[model samples]
Target: MKIKANLQNLQKLLPSSWLEKLQYIHSILLFRWILHGRSQPLACNQKSAMVFSPHQDDETLGCGGMIAQKREQGTQVVVVFVTDGQGSGGLETSRDKIIQIRKQEALTALSILGVAPSEIHFLQKTDGRLQELSSQEQQQTIKQIAELIKYYQPEEIYVPHRKDCHRDHEATYQLVKLAIFQCGIKVELLQYPIWLFWRAPLFILLKLQDITAAYHLSITSVQEKKARAIASYSSQIQSLPRDFIKHFLGAYEIFFNAEL
Candidate 1:
């Protein structure tokens, strides 16, 4: 926690752009080290899995490779987008239009990863404001997710990392976790990172347990498919920072195991 506090203080002193660049560089180095480090390769033996994304394109960004590999192995994979993506627009585009555009992009991306259209679900919750949901609204959202879990009964569930440096992502993790517990099921929970790479230092993000619990899914064989899947998010690629989306196209995707 002290490391995170010092980094937060340093962040306040540095230019925003410079700090982001530094974080990105450090993230890259950390990723490379993990790729070669002691983490074991993931075994794709699950009969079924579900991935929860806070936004339209996050599923592809964080779990695209694993999804692709699992699909190839004949594992049933369902993807759920928790938000409506209303905030992903510039001043020119209307909220509803941006939501529709992002939803279409998500469909195309997941299709490329071999997830059937029938298996993709959109919860249509408010974007960029998940943390602002009222107490009753929060329970309603959790109940909705719990219903889906009861229906799917997946052996494994994937969600954004708890400390992903984005409020929506953090909220998604908490919501999904509560839903899992509510359903009273024992399932493997895998947490993947997205914005943390560009927004946080590695030292501040890692806990001792996480270091030993890291898992790597090798996407080398399916990297091209993953690349094409990521490319389907043309809206994000054009609007986000230059090269920001490329970091996810690496040979491996990292996930950390979490329990209840």
Candidate 2:
């Protein structure tokens, strides 16, 4: 659990996907969580928190429960969508149509997570091309994010973690890393699961939820909102397996949020 442990060692023992996951967690606490020390709470009187997601539904699919719990604790949460997710072959015949659908879905999903419409920010980045952005563009994106960081000035910033099979997730992570440091804000970067990590069962350092503590949302509106959000991405449906969506459509929803 030593932060000083060679990255090459982890690289040898774990696949690239798993290694990327650890890199994110390590950034937050430098392996203290893995070493069995007690986890520290955020600064007292914190009111606002931010979540950065690559797609429309990821924020809700990944952390809706914890978001609700935090809101109940009197924290104001802002969920940012990095992309409209408009490049699927199946969801629709046109990109414009997909964007329109996704925007509505995002608003509905954020509402389910207890966020007001004013709290949502859409960056409108192209979905699926997040990593292909040029270095120059990436730098500019970082600078622009600094302005946003100043505006929100959230003490807790959650971004998609590395090891995501989806390119957008990785790009969003890189942007968040650069922006937070550039803005000189010492916010904790929490990772949310997307394609590759959903089936993942364990983490080397942190486990934010336990089987005993896992609770289902009782409000049927939350489930409906989740469904509406997922359905909003008409363009990306082709990328998802039919079986995956079939199994996912249910009243129950669970998620994990852990800082490295």
Candidate 3:
């Protein structure tokens, strides 16, 4: 019954037919085994880390359990949300109202994940339009991110994977890369994939060499906390497909090492 309900939600949100969805699931399963066999258990040893999210709920979706565990270990985790989150609102809702709602939701979610409000940073960049930024605007965004890196001086950084199949995610990765370069900081970059499971092209999936090198972090101890944190994103829970939510609540979180 639960699976059926989630599939119904997915059908409404995605244009793909049932057959296509099944194919996607098959690919995900095959890749999951490959990743599992090759992955090493990730350690929560960093004293400080920065997580860059393309939107409000992405941090929770991608690495909420990791964040919870890191906080438990007394690691300073800074979450940076790159967009205003206004793009998720319905047409009937006012832009400002939705943004405020998303911001509050983010606060509630992060709080559940043990992130202090002071440690959260919202860049307020226009959502869904990161690819359309002017050169000057891009430079400014890069500078802002660089400044944040300088301020945090984290030993590690997390961002969406380059092939996550979302434009915003891709743009965020590029911007963060540039920011690291501009700041001349040497931090381990861990890329988390949100859309790749369902949206990545076959060619990307065929990159076994790269995909197999991914790391898996066990969240068994903090799975409850992660679920609570994910639940706090009420807006997203009610809007996005339920299966998407379920996928994040898995026993482990996967992260790819930066392709330096």
Candidate 4:
């Protein structure tokens, strides 16, 4: 009787045909909310965050919605780009041109997302060689981040996870961790995944922080930015797995609070 009752309740949220496909998801999210209770309402003054990206477009792919949501709430957000994306294009495209183009696209993306110019900081490292940085260089980068952490003193920081699939993303994650450890700041750390958004469901286990951002997650908006961002990479796009676009279409801000 309970099974039948539950099914009747589930039917209201989704079509009958989708019940089989969505049963686990619905039950898990339901159980999660029950255990986690509800997110406390944050006052506008307390909504500040720092976001670190391994390269251009990462901020968009990972935390764009969350950033918009915070920005609208007058939450302070600072975006730090770890690389200029020099290696993201083909031989036909000069490295200088590709970097400039990606920078411009990033700015355009920020405008669309409502992040201001003062909030962006570029680390200006070699695009594909972040992992190969000298130990001294890595320390220097981390020191810079430490200073930023001290200066901004954000209550939360968003970074790519150590388990990131890409070398640059993974390296940036490590660098941030070292910096935070060095600074001894007790700020909450949230990890956002681009390549690993759904590689594992466990990645989305963070306390959901929903603040109703302004972007219309319409197919038209997502597709337009997605195509432009993907096209910005002339040679790099084909090397991406076939399912990449489909994955980005999920258009949801996912996070994990493992460090918290």
Give a tens-digit lDDT track for model 3, residues 48-152: 889999999999989898899999887899999999999994434888888898999999998988999999999999999998899999999999999999999
Candidate 4 structure, TM-score to reference: 0.68
By summed lDDT, which 10 consecutive residues of candidate 3 come out lowest?
A: 198-207
Alpha-carbon runs more than 4 Å astray in model 3: 1-24, 27-31, 89-91, 203-206, 209-212
For model 4, the run of ten residues with the poorest summed lDDT: 210-219
Best by lDDT: 1
How well does candidate 2 score on lDDT at residue 2? 65
Query: How far is 86's C-alpha from truth in model 4 (Å)?
Result: 0.6
Q: Give the per-residue lDDT of model 1 (tens digit) for 166-244.
A: 9999999999999999999989999998876677656566666664578898888889999998888888887776546
TM for every model, in the order presented, reads: 0.91, 0.65, 0.88, 0.68
TM-score between candidate 2 and the true structure: 0.65
* lDDT (C-alpha) at residue 178 in model 4: 88
- The segments of candidate 2 whose C-alpha lies over 4 angstroms from its true place after superposition are 1-47, 198-239, 242-260
Ranking by lDDT: 1, 3, 4, 2
Q: Clashing residue pairs, candidate 4?
A: none
Residue-pair clashes, model 2: 2
Q: Which ten residues in a row have the lowest lDDT in candidate 2?
A: 210-219
Candidate lDDT values, in order: 0.87, 0.62, 0.84, 0.66
